[model samples]
Target: MRVMGIDPGTVVVGYGVIDSDAGRETMIAYGVLTASVKEKPAQRLSILYKSLEKIVLKFKPDAVAVETPFVSQNVSSALAIGRAQAVALLAATNRGIPTFEYSPAQVKQRVASYGASSKEQIQQMVKMQLGLSEIPKPSDAADALAVALCHLSEVHVSGLLGEQTPKRKRRSV
Candidate 1:
């Protein structure tokens, strides 16, 4: 399965694409989309939408997994991030791709084996898991890859459960 992971932001949105099969993950692409400060908020959002759309078209991912916003001391920052995340979701939805949201703690736990893992630790794990020569730059890109990895793991678990379970009739509740 091919998955696109997004780490959304107004100024710089990070993205990563990976292909997974039989419990192995291979990196396809990873990068950031930057919006200039001089641009208006609406323009920035437009840019983000278009950039994300192009990525979707290019990668043709089966699903998109995004990191959800965590509460921040600065309300405005959180709000902006929320808006960017909305745009990211819309882009994927418009393309008819399934989207899944994961919290930062989930992403950290999946990628680093600890919910409170540091950015450096996440980067290291992402690098090692993907067999990259070095850590992905800008931190956000690494986080995006981590989100994809988390979804891939989820997919594997779901498959295993499906194989172990037998089909049963549902009773009216």
Candidate 2:
């Protein structure tokens, strides 16, 4: 299965593509899509959406796993990130691809075996799991990979147990 994981931000959206086969995961590509803060909000969002759409069209991932925006004390900031998350999700849904969402803690726990694992720990685990010699550049990209791997792990575990993983609700975001 090919999975595209996304860590969304208004200014920078992180993405990683991975191929998982029989429990083995391999990194296919990873990068960040950046939008200038100087640009108008609508323009920045357009940039994000177009870049992400290209990724989806090119990779044609079987599933897309995206990190949910963390609730923040700053409501505006949280909302902005949420918009970015929506943009990523829209790209997948428009292509008729299945999409899933994972919380940051869930991603850390699934990838590093500890919910409280540090960012560096998650990055190291991503590198190890994908057999990359060096950690993926740009921490956000590594985080995206973790989200993808987390979803794959969940799917594998559920299949092993002869159970179905709960589906995430889709929103217009």
Candidate 3:
């Protein structure tokens, strides 16, 4: 399956694409979308949405997995992240692709095998799992890749249990 993972943010939205087959995952692409901080909130979201939409069309992923925003004391920041996530969902769903969301903790547990794993640990593990020569640049991109990996792992486990689909939050366009 070809999966695209998103780590959404107002200023810098990260994305990663990968292909998984029979327990092997291969990196297809990883990068971030940036909008100037000086831009208005809505303008920034528009830029992100357009860029992400182009990516979705270009790669044509079979599924999209996005990381949900972590709880924060800064409510506004959290809300902005949520908006960014919605943009990702819309981009994929508009293309008639299925979408799934994973929490930051869930991503960490799946990629690093520990719920409380640090960012460096997750990055390192992602590198090792994909057999990359080095850690993926830009922490957000690495985090996005982890989200994709988490979804693949969940699906694999579900298949092992004789299920047709993984038990995850799913949204259709």
Candidate 4:
């Protein structure tokens, strides 16, 4: 399966694409979509949407996994992240891809075997899982890869249990 994972943010959205087959995961591409602070909020969103569309077009992922926004003390920041996530989802949906959202804790636990694993630990694990020599640059990109790995693991387990589809929560707009 080819999967594209997204770590969405207004200023810097990270993405990772990977192909998994026969219990082996291979990294295809990983990078961040950076938006300038000088741009207006709407303009930043436009940039994010365009960058994500380009990725989806280039990779043609079968599935998209995205990190869900965690609750934050800063409501405005959370809102901005939510908006960015929405755009990311829309980009995938427009291309007929099935999108899955995972929480940060779930991603950490799946990738590192600990929900409380630090960012460094997650990055190391992602590198180790894919047998990469170096950690993926831009922490957010690594995080996105972790999200995709988590979904792949979940799907594998589900298949073992003879399930065709994994449980997913529908996001209400």
TM-scores of the candidates are 0.91, 0.94, 0.97, 0.95
Clashes of 4: 0
Which stretches of model 2 miss by more than 4 angstroms? 164-173
Stretches > 4 Å off in candidate 3: none
lDDT of 1: 0.86
Question: How far is each candidate from the true structure, as Cα RMSD in Å?
Answer: 5.2, 1.6, 1.0, 1.4
Question: Against the true structure, whose lDDT is highest?
Answer: 3
Task: Write model 1 residue lDDT over 44-120, tens digit each, in one string.
Answer: 99999999999999999988888888886988888889899888888888988888888889889888889999988
TM-score-sorted candidate list, best first? 3, 4, 2, 1
Comparing 3 with 4 on lDDT, the higher-scoring candidate is 3
Q: What's the CA error at residue 167 for candidate 2, in Å?
A: 2.3
lDDT of 3 by residue, 62-155 (tens): 9899999988698888898999999999999998998999999988888888999999999999899999999999998998999999988888
Candidate 3 structure, TM-score to reference:
0.97
Best candidate, TM-score-wise?
3
Model 2 residue 23 CA deviation (Å) reads 1.0
- Report the C-alpha lDDT of model 4 over 1-173, residue by residue, as the tens digit: 99898999989999999999899999999999999999999999999999899999999999888888988698888888989999999999998888888899989988999998999999999999999999999998998899889989888878999986566632333
lDDT score, candidate 2, position 78: 83
- The per-candidate count of clashes, in order, stands at 0, 0, 0, 0
- CA lDDT, every prediction? 0.86, 0.90, 0.91, 0.90
